[model samples]
Target: MGGEHSPHVPERVPSDDDPADDLPDGLLVADRDGRVVVFNSAARRMTGIAASAALGRDFRDVLPLHDAEGRDWWKCLSPYEGLTIRTRHPERSLFLADGHELLVTAGYRRDAEGRVERFSVCLRDAAHRARQERDRADLVSTVAHELRSPLTSVKGFTATLLAKWTRFNDDQKRVMLETVNADADRVTRLITELLDVSRIEAGRLEMHRQVVDLAGEARKVIAGRVAAGDPEDRFRFEARGELPEMWLDPDKVDQILGNLVENAVRHGAGTVTIVVEPDAHKEGAAVTVRDEGEGIPPEAAQRVFRQFWRGPGGNRRGGTGLGLYIVKGLVEAHGGAITVRRGPEGGAEFRFTVPAGAPDYAS
Candidate 1:
């Protein structure tokens, strides 16, 4: 016979010995005395606690409640009645525990007499989803930064070259004309990257196969950038081994190198050195561009390649911010990887790999 009580009892009463009392979903039951009567398998899985040990203990002992400020949270529970509790902190993303993040909903349950009986919580891991959101935001910002400066120069200089070309002497005319043409080429590259990155995101960037002499191409890019006014003494280029012509897309390789060079010039101080090292694992070559300027802050390293990721302390000198991000994307498109680290003499260094091959120079 049961003790005299109201007809409104718990939907399911869990005994200390009944296996069926334990549910796969988070379930907890407390008695009128405010002691735990049942803490089921489901509850244990969500909170990472053992059900057997929670039985006969206070509910607070099972899941020690902590307020958003890390203060005691159980005092907020109502002794007269149970109520659902939703998180109030909008910035509280997800619960972090044991190197993992869990999405959770917490609530309370009561008996027919309006007495608190249980506190239930459900949770699911959310790391993958959060990472995807972060990556997407970074891509957008990167593209925006990369386009701003070159577009400004291409537009401003082309107009200046046009407005002043007729007033110049023959030598001046030749120089100004060459500069105009170079700026045009830079614009073309910006547009191409905008489209290429979009396609890469949509899984659309295609590689045209051909023999590519990376050394010659690198030298040509260096020559053009140097001619365009990057100081000659401040820049050095080298090749370590006899690089054989292999198959790859030349335009993409050019874009990658150009972006890295631009990054070195924009972020680093003093001289920038380009070092090419051959790699057997890649059957390709590793290219490193290092500068003597101040290195990126430790906190900003991982975020450097993210899209639209502006450097700390706002507009980094003359950088529009898209160089590193576009460099990473272009290298990955060529089946390569790109990374940055502090250089030997307290500046930023960018490194990427390219298949040792010949590329079709733009006609």
Candidate 2:
């Protein structure tokens, strides 16, 4: 019987001039009979339904709510006060009559008799939030899949070595031990990337800014890579002109160069080159890392810096694809810009600049 009654059943209701109308959050109040009584300005803007059309309309009929899966969500509402639901459900979505979607949460108010006198629903545009959630889930799933392979290898090798310790020769044991260690290192690198991502997202990436010898730092990175047996002949370091000491974070510089060089050696074909030169336009110096591998396509140059953005051939090289993204962030944090273009050798060349003077890090 209550569902059949018209929305005008409530004789006294709050007018449009009520303070609730000025609230930022959308507020839709329905009477005990489930009729819309307080359709505020914010609610009208959120649902695109005028107060004149919604005020006397049944709440269920006027607010065509739906879940993320497009199932009717109005059924979740209850008329009794004690039976009301109030909480922010991130997975819930509200579908407007015009096909727009909104994220919604609901609450209810009760009279002295303990009966549900009014219901309120708050609404927000869900496009951005929903996209963020979906991206986060994708990242988690990708990272899990990446972690599983090395874990399997580590487990399998260690188990085999333990069981066959007495049966295998010293050389065989050493080879298996090296394989296990490589897998462990792979796992560690993935975990470190994950932590770096977390820090970047939280805006807590620490940068210790001081005058750094750019040429010296680049040489050290190249030396480290060579020492690690990453094709010593494949890497070449060159300085175009006299480079000066710049105010930069040395550790960040190492990370940037290391990621770029490692990426080059892993994906590029013949050679990887690191060049440092004085920036004519700015007082700082510019560094370029080039690889003779398959250069990035024109369309992919911009997207290469995005998190987890791997090209079509990315599968060939086992990488987390977070290197460029971290490099971009660290470079920008030092008040610099980075760009990618076709190298003179017909390969991918990544060029970034470091400011001569330190940026206002306090901000």
Model 2: lDDT to the true structure: 0.79
Candidate 2 deviant stretches above 4 angstroms:
1-92, 95-98, 104-125, 230-233, 241-245, 359-363
Candidate 2 lDDT, 1-363, residue by residue in tens: 135656438533558478987787677777778877787787888777887777766788878876666667776544453343442334356787667888787766776656777777777667767788898999989999888998999899889988878999999988988998998998899889889888877888887877788888889988898788876788888988876667787888899988988777776777889999998888889999998878889999989998898844776777888999898888887778999988888788999997787445422
On lDDT, the candidate that comes out on top is: 2
Model 2, residue 129: distance off in Å is 2.8
Error of 2 at 184 (Å): 0.7
Each prediction's RMSD over C-alphas, in Å, is 11.9, 7.9
- 1-363 in candidate 1: lDDT tens per residue? 112333444334445766734443445555655456666665566567765666666665655645445554445544324343432213223433343445545555665655545545444435655786887787666656666666676677667767887776888766766776766676676676567657866767677767777777778778888899877897898889865565767787787778787777776788888887786576888888898988888888899986556654456464445566777777886778877888998888888886654455212
TM-score for candidate 1 = 0.51
lDDT of 2 at 133: 89
* C-alpha RMSD of candidate 2: 7.9
Clashes of each: 18, 0
TM-scores for all candidates: the values are 0.51, 0.68
